[model samples]
Target: MKIFNLFIFLFFVTTLSNAQEAKQDFYKRSFIAYEGCEDSKDLERCYEISFHEFLAKHINRKALKDSIFFEAKKDTITVSASILYDENGKVVKRHSRISNPASNRIEGLEYLLDSIPTVKPVLDKKNNGVALSTRKLFGFYLNKAKDTIVPIFGYTPSEVPYEIIEKVPVYKGCDESMSNEDLKNCMNDKVVQLISENFRTNLAIKHNLKPGIQRIYVMFKIDKKGRVKDIVARGPHPEIEKEAIRVIKKIPRLKKPGYQRGKPVIVPFSIPIVFAVSD
Candidate 1:
């Protein structure tokens, strides 16, 4: 009789666990992810989410998901995650992943694959955590691994090299109910941090040092959504400019791109990033 009762209790627990409903809050995240990621199957879209996506799709992200990336009070291509509210519709987790290359941080380099999908967090634990249902895991990995659209690579006519001073998400600040730190920590703000870091790192690498500071012109289309497109480098010597363009392409994606109206469109932007070694 005792064994029979235990079986019944176990059965009830299983039923209850499975009965939990999948919340709609997860739906809201797709907008944020899509906006912040800016429709890239192969690029850095936002800061924290970019980092997470980098991990979910990145062959090696599995190793460091638990530990936050911190060195010298800064982040180097890592995500800091803490599980918070776990109700059906909420996941109040605190996360930070900063990878500034200018400060000599070895992050965002040696990345061969351009786009990687982050595990789409599902309110259903079955699709998110350990032992995620096979269906969810397979679906998530398949979506990230496969490219939705063929990449359209664009370029400019100028013959000079340049660099992006900074890139960030454009959006209203987080809700007032959020703590000051959390508000600032919103995923959009991290965009600037990522841009600055990538900019500095490329400079440190002497990307354009050989014939530094030549008249170079770069033209790239920023889609209506503000994501970068049609990157081209043109200046005095086309060869070196191409090299610069190559590096520029290495930078991550912009989460919130500039917009003209309701639809996503491409806008043009230019910059001359000078490379000089200080004495």
Candidate 2:
């Protein structure tokens, strides 16, 4: 009787999981098209290119000059904002939120998103207009020595290069007194150890992956608060990618966040998980 009851419980759990998955599939993200991206086969890529072009054309350089921090801080500043598209394709800047607190100090970005021109309405799989959300990140490195600014743009503001960070984030239990290079190596080693212990190496066998080397590329950010955020993974199989993300999210908050020019800043890290599958 106990065995029968256990079977029933597992059956119920499986049924519930499948139901939830179905619901998620029904509400999956829809394709979004910017003005120039309307007929592009790769809408996402096209939209990014078009959006960057728009920013380059519309961003007010004069307003940026007004920000005192830009001239004084001599550090890289990154700002991110959400862009919302209603069912009818209208930009609702008022409803969008600026994510970073430092964004408030940049005069140029205050109204930068408000100038977003209308884009083609997004439609769901059923051809019904649906609301969509997108994000943009603007960054500029202030070269105090050169007395100039270098502009950078990407999908996320926290996607800063690892080599560019002056101080890499410190993993728990790692000595903070180590040199910057040593600290970086220590943190990476710890993270890799965590992944190896937690990631299910048997996934390749279960998924029937080809008998060869397989790699999963993962990217995430250690935010200014020293907590892991924005985990993304890509692999041959969805299950493998999901497992990679799970292991990454299990990392504990660090002893200290990364620093640049004496100020805490977001640090982006990417790692590849490679394994060999047997025949």
Off by over 4 Å in 2: 1-159
Model 1, span 107-213: residue lDDT tens? 44223123322443323323443211110000012122332212111211111111111121232443534432343245324433333344333332343344333
**What tens digits encode model 2's per-residue C-alpha lDDT throughout 30-89?**
456788777787776677667666654564556445554444453776545456777777
> Which of the numbered candidates is closest to the native, going by highest TM-score?
2
- Each model's lDDT comes to 0.32, 0.63
**What TM-score would every model get versus the actual structure?**
0.26, 0.46
Pairs with steric clashes in candidate 2: none
Worst 10 residues of 1 by lDDT: 4-13
List the candidate 1 regions with Cα displacement exceeding 4 Å.
1-213, 276-279
